[model samples]
Target: MSSSIYSTRRWRKLRAAKLALQPLCEPCSRRGKLVPAYSVDHIKAIAAGGDPYPALDGLMSMCVSCHSIKTNARDNPHAFGKGWKAAFKGCDLDGRPLDPDHPFLASSEG
Candidate 1:
């Protein structure tokens, strides 16, 4: 989150365009929710060697709550760590959709 890159007109336009293109919280979508997204996030953050201005593939739209949680987790990896993966364990090995009664679904039900 460099100030210089974030302040550019190009970044602003891209953010707006991305939000319009996919107006749903990406993380929520994967979990079968329909939250509207208002912020664009980088899948690979700039601090993690991602491009300062990445393309659509590296970007996602997210709601304020989702954004805050993700940012907080990322900012403090040790506390949150990689526990986020547990949330996605509902998917198949390759992240494919599984049967409704799939055992993995139980992990997310609680």
Candidate 2:
């Protein structure tokens, strides 16, 4: 939580990349909507011992809400059972699997 995802060259690169690709958000793309990119999430996290880029296959773009969810899960593994190991398992604050595509699974490929 202290020194993870939030601080990374990859995130910086991703933020710029997202703008290059589209100013809109990815979820909005799926919904046929166009919204600004508030956060470029890992779709995976670091504390969970993940490599964001490799895990998501380069799908590293999310909004602030999305990014925070991933960050929370990564920061609180003990609160979750089995550590919620998946590349696309978004859950509530409690850590129960939410929408599989909620965008928090890219933490690692292992």
Candidate 3:
């Protein structure tokens, strides 16, 4: 989905209200952290047949880092698959990901 939808005035108002009500990141809270929420994420992702302007039923507070992780997971489900996970275990934890073919490995050839 295009991010332009989130730039709408209506969405801005809703996002403000959502952040005010829940200032803390929902996922971080669940993981026993207390980081402030920086964005209002759609609980049901916009790419997965979710409504662009969904009601409050499909929204939650998120930090930027957590939001990125969530988005990456949704966009690349195959990366979390059994074989992929095993392959990912061999990757350097601190390396920048340069390989387009492997989600976790950073290709030195690049």
Candidate 3 — which pairs collide? none
Model 2, span 1-110: residue lDDT tens? 63564568876676677666656665444444466667665443443455654433444455565455555655686744333334233444556444433334333234
Candidate 2 matches the true fold with a TM-score of 0.46
Give residue 108's error in model 1 in angstroms. Answer: 25
Candidate 1 C-alpha lDDT tens digits along 3-66: 5787899999989888878989877787778999988987666876878778875687888877
Give stretches of model 1 more than 4 Å off.
82-89, 92-110
TM-score of 1: 0.72
Residue 95 error for model 3, in Å?
36
Superior candidate under lDDT, 2 versus 3? 3
Arrange candidates, best TM-score first: 1, 3, 2
User: lDDT at 49 for candidate 3?
Assistant: 68
Q: Rate residue 36 of model 1 by lDDT.
A: 97
* Comparing 1 and 3 on lDDT, the stronger one: 1
The full ranking of all candidates by lDDT, starting with the best, is: 1, 3, 2
Question: lDDT score, residue 77, model 3?
Answer: 80
The candidate that achieves the highest lDDT relative to the unseen native structure: 1
lDDT tens string, model 3, 1-110? 56788889999988888888899987566556799999898765577666767776467788887676656655788644443233223323345331123533224436
TM-score of each: 0.72, 0.46, 0.63
